[model samples]
Target: MFSLRTISSLWRTSKTDLIVQCQQQKQRLSSATFTVHPYKLHRIDEGPSTEVTCTRDQAINYYREMTTIRRMEAAANALYKEKAVRGFCHLYTGQEAVAVGIEDAITKKDAIITAYRAHGWTYLRGVSLVGVLAELTGRETGCARGKGGSMHLYCDRFYGGNGIVGAQIPLGAGIALAQKYTNSGEITLALCGDGAANQGQVYEAFNMSALWKLPIIFVVENNGYGMGTSAERASACPLFYTRGDYVPGIWVDGMDVLAVRQATEFLAKMCRDGQGPFVMEASTYRYFGHSVSDPGTSYRTRDEVQEVRRSRDPITMFKENIIQAELVTSDELKQIDVDIRKQVDEAQQKSRTDPELPIEHLYHDVYANMIGNDIRGITPFQRHKHQNTSKPCNITI
Candidate 1:
């Protein structure tokens, strides 16, 4: 025997089914439909927003930056093979998106500080290719006068290519402090690697920056490994993004340039507005070793690296997406490649031929010498004032 409630339930089910059928029929005939999928309710990657306002020219500029970095890294690799660059040199071959995307979100006056793998950031921050390449080659005309090598490249707006593991974190915080002290309406991007995430200073900096509301963005370039050690092996908290408390962190798809750019812009804005420190852990992979000396294959398998290159290469992924959107063509990208190659070749030649440093230049910038103290024996007072300031001449003239 059917109860009254059972009969009502059956009738309601029939009515709901008829309504769904009518809606489906209407959707079939309509030009557009806004049907919501229950599966889509599952949250995926989220930041400010993935979409951005970019013109064709702006898109090309991004392409240029990424391409330049790739070519520069290739050139560095070639130089290393020839034994031109000695010591620890970290390559930014597969991590172009991190720098380019973050660069777009900040102004020209803003500061950028990163770990040892910083060629890409300095290049993006308006340092000339020749200057950077020359520095790596130890030429006198380098931005740092050839004193600082690959792991110490620096420029006006960009802080460094720091050598110490994770030491750049506090330095970035200090730069942010300077910005805050002067009330500069700029944000500082402090980038670190997965391996450096284990450094204690990173947490200390995060704590201080968050407590005092410093305008800084802490970025972790989680390329799966810190040097040869995998993130899982090195970091107890493998999720580098949400490691500490107070500061909220977001994980980003580092292979998608647009996604990185949009997310960076959002985070930069938050920090610039005095929202304190924001953490971003970009899931990126580097194609090279921690340094030029290591083969980069000792720890990870060749297949794993190749898989990332084939499937998630940031530059390639961006090119495909842009082409699909009719933003650029293969022919145009090829031209860009040709242009970049030419520039890199010329820069390499320039670096090779850069003049040798004079012996005097070594001590010129070493210490702050007060005026009239020409330790090299040529005193300005002797020549102009007729006073022998030089160690009293032995001959009584």
Candidate 2:
């Protein structure tokens, strides 16, 4: 039996040792702590932690992913200007962190369906720069094989870049319900813009998803505008996360990649543990207009956008933090920048010059197994037979 003084001394030493061990583990991981915006939770006592500690590997990977997205968006902008990508083209220029962070927290098996501003998510979900750019330009090498253009890119588990505002929410809920029915241990993330926040169908999705206790997360990428109207002007209750009356919600700093990852991981855990669907609002900003043609300056000032770029650009912020932590040097990041620019440039030019899908291939990409499936949408007089256009793909995973 030890004396009380001796026991106290031993306890103190053990606690000190534990603290030192934690510190040493952090050092070993080459991790850096970032102070992010505190999450506001709805119908919950606890939320995602405000402090995000990212390891060296995570920082490097995230930086590369985000930089690629930014460069790709820049390429899309140039393509839009050149009229290579026609129709409604939306660029994910300033919202790279949201897509990159969300992807980091979720598995490829988990599903994602988003609105028209989907080039970034399409790339993160598995499409390469060439696939996305080619899809935007309606080329044969596109992920959707020139059928699904800028507003309808798709991959294995990724649903699409839905053209209809707020349409993907309920469809995503259905996917979640399918996951529930199949016991597949998968969850779905349905993302919509702040502009589509007020759609009555969105609330219906919220209600049904909550009632069913489905494993899904509803994300509102509030880039401050729905078309030309500001979020405040568009939504009566602009706090989108709180709009889910019965379902729990989380408000995340969308500009901070680590913060978005932390929040997504937290919410996804709850859903996997059978807590049902939740809502999240990623408060971010977009450098470009709602679409390419919006000029992006009619409603907002050029100075305001420029200020956000200077202060809160996700790539720059993450770079500075990682540099301060000694996880990466400035020269290494510069090299990475050059590499990404070169890759995107090469892909952009390829997509620009890629061959358009042949006229007879209109029936391709419509079905997976057309063995006995009848084409009800078409007439009996068949001009083009449905065929599988499987080609050896060279997509960068």
Candidate 3:
């Protein structure tokens, strides 16, 4: 057995500061004095082998895409100040890696379903910034043709930004079922927030996925809150990885792009190999509100938020990791930033002048067929008036 003194010293060095120090210290002493134990210390330098898959160009692309999401949201924030884009807009500022890293493990054929804060995922999946911006501004060119706004952007293989708490979980399972039925080599990735972890539908989806052996990955983007309430307050099983009791789960360091990618790649492979349902609880934080209208800082302490931002900023971590590994240079990263800013500026300019959704489209996407009962309330004349207008305003609730 290792001596208690040696074990105590090791435990002190290994555990997080947030860990219950006294309990951990006591446990360390007991284990050292009671039994022989063997363990290996791993270094961050000894990362997952497939990180090499992230080449210079891939790293540059990831960096640029993350930056564009960040800058675009910042622009949206600025526009909100100027009273341009209205209604509930949730920015994926600090949690970019949760989306970007997961996407690294997926293909265009794979499907993704997520909750309200979904701009990052849509953009990563190739939804043009012009479309997303116009959607935020309620222009017809937007992903949901301006009707869905921030909480409901959709694209090919991207299900939606579902507003209902955990409703998208089962929808993701259904998509996976379709993939299974067709024997398509594709997996469905369903994303949920820390708050939505408590929703009954999530567990229902978990049960369904396990029963049918669906190729689905349930990812909990633990951004620390369900609206104004923290995860600690909402979930009895606050350690979200274990929430999917029947499904195997992996807790990932969501702030590290490489970590998120490595973990996701592992989970994705498991699903691809017909391992059925898997869960990934990515530990991340967001810098924005439950929505654009609310100031995020009001509920959470700035110091707490800043601590995570300073230490665990995903974009910074990616840059530092790449530079340290000799994968990219500081100058190259700066150039990427420049290009991204220009693209964002161009997209912003285009969104402002875009026209609103035409009346035909409003009725077109509502259902496969426009039933008489659907438009029963609005008479022909009122419908004609709405249809003739080029821009529709105040769709916000």
* Candidate 2 accuracy as lDDT: 0.91
Best by lDDT: 2
lDDT of 1 by residue, 71-178 (tens): 998988888788777676889988898788878877888888898898888788887888888888888877777778799987767889898889999999998988
Better of 1 and 3 by TM-score: 1
Ranking by lDDT: 2, 1, 3
lDDT of 3 by residue, 241-336 (tens): 777787877677777666677777777887889986888888889887888777777778989988987888889977876676555779989998
Residue 255, model 2: lDDT of 95
For candidate 1, the lDDT comes to 0.78
Error of 3 at 18 (Å): 51
lDDT minimum window of 10 residues, candidate 3: 32-41
lDDT of each: 0.78, 0.91, 0.78
Displacement of the residue 12 alpha carbon in candidate 2, Å: 37
- RMSD, every candidate, angstroms: 14.6, 8.2, 14.7
Pairing residues by index, what is the TM-score of model 1?
A: 0.81
lDDT of 2 by residue, 1-397 (tens): 9999999999999999999998986686587788888888889898878888888899999999999999999999899899999898998998999999999999999999999999999999989899999999999989898788899998888999999999999999999999998898889999999989899999999999999999999999999999999999887899999999898998998999999999999999999999979999999999999999999998999999999999999999989988988778899899999999999999999999999998867766466656653454466764446666685332221
